[model samples]
Target chain A: FRKRQPSVASLIQGIRDGDKTALSRAITLVESKNKTHLVQANQIIEACIADKKNTLRIGITGVPGVGKSTFIEVLGKYLTNQGKKVAVLAVDPTSSLSKGSILGDKTRMEVLVRDENAFIRPSPSEDSLGGVARKTRESIILCEAAHFDVILIETVGVGQSETAVHGMVDFFLLLKLAGAGDELQGIKRGIMEMTDTIVINKADGKNKQAANLAKIEFTRALHFYPPKENGWVPKVLQCSALENEGISEVWQTILNFKDATADAIYDKRKYQNKFWLLQTIEDNLKMQFYEDTAIQQQLEQLTTLVMNAKVSPFVAAEQLLALHQKKLK
Target chain B: FRKRQPSVASLIQGIRDGDKTALSRAITLVESKNKTHLVQANQIIEACIADKKNTLRIGITGVPGVGKSTFIEVLGKYLTNQGKKVAVLAVDPTSSLSKGSILGDKTRMEVLVRDENAFIRPSPSEDSLGGVARKTRESIILCEAAHFDVILIETVGVGQSETAVHGMVDFFLLLKLAGAGDELQGIKRGIMEMTDTIVINKADGKNKQAANLAKIEFTRALHFYPPKENGWVPKVLQCSALENEGISEVWQTILNFKDATADAIYDKRKYQNKFWLLQTIEDNLKMQFYEDTAIQQQLEQLTTLVMNAKVSPFVAAEQLLALHQKKLK
Candidate 1:
């Protein structure tokens, strides 16, 4: 016989009492596509928001082979050792297509996965980055309510995932492999602007000298960027997740950033809240308009006419909007 | 007595015959906010769309003091001397507030303003960037119909104007002073990614060596960026717009870029058309939602609640959207 599912009230109580199982179940509800589950998830989210403890949300990103998993594992363990309740989540939108990449294998985190104070969750399988980001954001609140003092969001630094992760986190860490030519090829266009710290990973063994040089190169490169709005200058450091070296220094830099930008952090979160409020409404509005059968039928024809310069894009947009409004009526 | 307004048919015929007066009048209609003028503007735009000649649209941007007006003057004169019809336009969203900082004074381009083969138009006074961009885009079609072989769009690079200009043009040019610390300040985060060429201005006499050094620095910096989507690599050039030196080289570089990216240009324009279609629709949708008095009344309260973590932003958005839908019903 299958076990009975717990009610929303019991789940909330358990999460408040720091029950990892209840927190995971609540997050599952948040990730569900079912209509009833959505309503229940919102209720849980509402309750959790009020009960949330002080939390630090850090987003870590790097290319696929940049050792993001190893770095995260070591950092998560470090925090747990400091008596912090740590929660690890991934935001890989491509997970659904890749059948789960980052954090998919629980064995990747080995020691951290087995730790009593650590909770590790794989990315939700979602077709859209927006969907995955929403799930991860909600999970953050749920994790916080479960008394997780530190929440680490991991994403592969490709496509628009870094941007999504950047929006949700307090500090954004970009991991890079030394001598990988990332610095020479340039990091992605906008990624550097969003980064708070750059960590050159695998800085052990033969890679030590190269990693230091890479750190210096990145430091000089970071100087070119305009001052960040939060008034915290971005720093570059070298680390070796393999040897477990410089991990504490990375953590220390983050603490320094947090201390220096305390007021800015409050303002950033407020701005992020407003951004999400508008973003969600806009996303839904577009989905409603684009999903309409009548609009879809005309969109292709209108797109062709606009592309060929036979009709002004503005006029075509006006026509479709009129049709949508008429359908609504 | 007021002169009689030209009929839409006459205006179209005149623009087709390369009449500057007709082109100017049509653009005025495009910029007008009056409902009747808007209708007439659409008719003229529809007519001109079919009559458009093969034209190259180049967007030039720099900070206010970076000699944008002088550069455009020199470039426009060069193109006109090459037996090409040139039209210069500006897209300054801040024009209304700044009392028209750019291209506001026709005397700034005194030589080009007097050339029968060239037409210059100041930016329309619009409160929003979208409004100004739409006007400039429609004006481009009208100018192309007027047989202008090349269109020059100028914008101040301090804000989102460059992005608006970038979206509408076939080529994007960034102008900067040699030692203005822009290269060291990193140029704007995403500006370099969109640029096809960087022109270091005022590279004459005392500034020539510094300009060349700046050029080398920029070339190295540009290497760090990933290869652009269009297979063509960006080039850096130094020019003294005041002395009209290197102006021809700038033109040559543009010609070379056009030759190399001819196919990409076609594809880019198609993509831009679709982008504008969706952009126009989305902008309108947002306007409709935000402008509703009832929605505005509740938005602030919801924003505060979301910022304080009392309500999920997603939930607040849903509540507002439902209210909006119910009101519509």
Candidate 2:
């Protein structure tokens, strides 16, 4: 008998039982833009929060062709072989712009895709910043509820998506190619600073020497950067997805990092949650003001006036705020 | 006749006539937090905007002991000797916090203070982000209206103020001391990218060789950074404010940069004005929302709840926003 409808409680129950189908449906709810789905998504997240399980959220980021998919596939298989359940999810906002998802293709990680212990989900198709952030974060909660101990969140290092992923994850890994012109070009400054571990991929064959040189260069470069709050120095490692080499070593480095910064990480997560709360409030407030019809009508004209320097920015802002206030009355 | 009343039109007229006293008064009005003074400030700014003159706005940043003041003094004197009026303004928010203003003190620049062609103003006492940015930017307009052909806006490279300074200036110069530990310590990443010219200060005497070495290192380091939209390569120069050597060369570099990126600089200012307009609106909206009494009252509890993971950040934000919306109704 096919069940046409299911209540939110039953969905939560199924997810708690580690049902992959329930996990997928739960993520769909969170990713949905519909108002009814959003409410249900919040309810599901609330229920999951009450029964939260521990998750090692690792964020992986690299430029395309940096072997990110291969590295993830190898790493995912390694963990699954160790008897840990793995879920690989993506937060690639650019995927929608490119007309297809980067990690959404099922063929890329064929082994991981078919592995019973491993689940792969692509990024939601939504493009709104707030919407995407909300969905990805909620999906993490659902994934954790489904007892996925190792959740790998993949994102392209090109844009603001790296920042979003960095905020949500416990560990942030930057995958880079060896001998790529100092291994720094095309990398954003903030993203480099946020990187917890720099992994040089495709280091198996003749590239081994270059990768080793890169490891030294990155080590020296990272030494110039101030140590993060956790006091664990960011490390550079060499890995070869083709040979399935250094996969466990990277995982061990992550474990050592977790051990070294347990207290700071715990406090950081709490602080981050509080930060997101305030940030959400700030964003919502701005959205409300900007969305007000009166403010919207005057925005273009005021912008032109400001561009022409006919009015000071502060005064222009006051005028718009006054318009919103007056209209509210 | 003792006249205490100066209408906005007369103030603008006096400013246009190069009356230093009138310029100072206009700047004071712009810096004022009083609601009444704000209206007059806008009028003065509006009138001054119409008569905007061609001025070279350079943003200079360095550490406290990086010879920033000495460099400014030498460079200011150099420009003034060439029959150019120079205005040096500090955006050192910390100076106010430290119980003394860096540029506010007249004794620091004994020669420049006494020079008829130079004007120096310290950071405003108000510490709010919007207040500081608004005051400094408006002061630039008043200084330009008062016939200051060269405006050197100084900010400590340690904070967000440098970014604000960079936004309003045509040229952003970073002053560094040679042999100062690679000369990159404590400087933020984004700051380096925004720099149009990196000047190695104190390059005279025994520091000359180290300064040259630092220049080379910086050039190589900067190569890794993406080029700005203006298509001008960021140059590194050696200067000694102590001996007044390289002052002319630095000025020449500025001239060359102006020649190379003239159109882009012009477009940048217009785009910056539009950006500031939108940014100011967003800030004001957030301030209004955050300043709501009921929302403030519940903020601490909500933050703790979010931190404890008892509630999702979005739900907490929704609750707070709903409360504010209900109160408005």
Go through the candidates in order and give each one's DockQ.
Answer: 0.65, 0.59
Across residues A70-168, which tens digit of lDDT does each residue of candidate 2 receive? 999999999999999999988877766776886789899998999999989998877655556667887888888899999999988645888888888
Residue B253 C-alpha lDDT in model 2: 96
lDDT, candidate 2, B109-211, per-residue tens: 8899899999999887666645676788889988998999999998875468888888889999999877655656666767777889999998888888899
Candidate 1 per-residue C-alpha lDDT over B1-329 given as tens digits, one digit per residue, 9 for 90 to 100: 75589999999999989999999999999999899999999999998886645679999988878899999999999999989999999999889898855787999999999999999999998889998999999999999999999999999865788899999999999998988555657467678888899999999999998898999888877766667878879999999999989999999999999999887887888788889999999999899899988899999999999988899999999999998887766
Worst 10 residues of 2 chain B by lDDT: B180-189
lDDT of 1 at A175: 94
Summing lDDT over every window of 10 consecutive residues in candidate 2 chain A, give the lowest-scoring window.
Answer: A180-189
iRMS (Å) per candidate = 1.9, 2.0
What proportion of the real contacts between chains A and B does each prediction keep?
0.73, 0.70
Q: Once model 2 is optimally superposed onto the true structure by TM-score, how far is the C-alpha of residue A269 displaced, in angstroms? A: 1.4
TM-score per prediction, in order, is 0.96, 0.94
Docking level for model 1: medium
Per-residue error (Å), model 2, residue B39: 1.1
lDDT for each residue of candidate 1 in A1-329, tens digit (9 for 90 to 100): 75678889999999999999999899989999999989999999999887745678899988878898889999999999999999999899888898955787999899999999999999998888888888898899999999999999999865799999999999999998887555646478788889999999999999988898898888877776667877899999989998999999999999999899987776787788788888999998888899989999999999999998899999999999999888877
